[model samples]
Target: MKGQSYSSISFATPSPKQYSETMLHAQQNHATNALRSESKIIPACLPTPNPSSPNFASRFRTDIVQLVETSNIHKHSDTCYKYWNANRGDKKTCRMRMPRKLVSNSTIDPATGDICMRRSDPWINNFNDYLITACRSNMDIKFIWSGSDAKALVYYITDYVTKT
Candidate 1:
């Protein structure tokens, strides 16, 4: 993980691929800050320009997060957003954000155990290269599997996206 990049988008859930050993250390440090354990969103010392900052590219796209949060839920299904494969028989699914009561929803295939995400889904991946030319940015936030922060993750997520 020495040369690898990390997400600066606050409330971002570091995808395992992008975050390997560095997060392991960060996870260990969570005991120091109990909130980190609950949210799995640590206050990393990553130094970079943030998209939410004033310098963010005004031309950069913001519709991806919009489609997920505000668009018609029915129309924003995995298929509509192109985040899932209807042809796949197992057809497991999950969401970056879900209704508070619908906590058990998984954007993964139960049978296949594969993450049901589309490579094309902008909101589902790190935006480092695509969104910023210099800053290492990652907007694709993974969900916290458990902890007290689970209840408040949606609120934090809104902040993360809107800041972008």
Candidate 2:
């Protein structure tokens, strides 16, 4: 009942329909691909460029892909398995969960009211194309559908803000 009015952005790679829609818009607008430097690296900070330009949609798609590739892909490190304990029979797992389980389609469970956003790539963190493009940085977003989720989010924010 609490989450009924709230909408969520989809997860993982954009669906083929989304990609095709972008392509169609680009074609309709006669947008041409802009040239880029040989280096694939994007600057850490970027100015918010004009979104009204004729090539905005096409350029936006390109920028989103580049930004995600450069920063959003997860790679496991020593810290990932920091909690593992063989003696105690604790299973090896990443504290910051990486390689999330793939969901082929976005769905809301009828009985439980759980939302599963569509996901394709396992190694990529959750991101919104528009948010990542505007901030020019990596981002992680999740829907707070239940009381437990809201509590966890509040705790996380409080802990982060109170940290020295």
Candidate 3:
């Protein structure tokens, strides 16, 4: 049995009917209510800026990093990969370049290290609009959904309104 040739062993492939049924089930699963939930929230993807605003970029990137770092996403590494790629083209190139972190103007509770904001106000939408406008005017924008429903909406609202 040691170093024996086993090339003659036959493999049993699934029959065509079985394969077709599996494919159909997969397709059905792909088109389910859970999958459809993601579509309910609008994608807030915007363009990367042209002649980028250093201030805006710094603030946005820092805020986004903080958000991602703090988020409860299960696969944090994969989320970071998607986010970094969407913002900075590729991981290697971005890592090579120096990044600017945005300063927050919000009152940070020394006790909690949390940047607090009121979630009850209409200004959230305004902030989202501002970010969308800034991205459109300044750079080529790309937004990859974080696989969490409402993440895009939350990012736009929080990043712009609570600008530090």
Task: Using lDDT, give the best candidate's number.
Answer: 2
RMSD for all candidates, in order, please: 17.0, 6.6, 23.8
Question: Could you say which candidate leads in TM-score?
Answer: 2
lDDT of 2 by residue, 144-164 (tens): 786667888999999999999
Instruction: Give per-residue CA lDDT, model 1, range 12-127, as digits (tens).
Output: 22233433443344444443336534665523322333567542332122222222222212223655435666676545545544321321222665664444322332333323
Q: Is candidate 1 or candidate 2 better by TM-score?
A: 2
- What local lDDT score does residue 35 receive in model 3, on the 0 to 100 scale? 38
Would you estimate the TM-scores of all the predictions? 0.22, 0.72, 0.16
Shift in Å, residue 134, candidate 3 = 2.9
Q: 29 in model 2: Cα distance from truth in Å?
A: 14
- What stretches of model 3 exceed 4 Å from their correct place? 1-105, 118-120, 126-130, 136-164
Task: Please give the range of 10 consecutive residues that has the lowest summed lDDT in model 2.
Answer: 1-10
Each model's C-alpha lDDT? Answer: 0.37, 0.67, 0.33
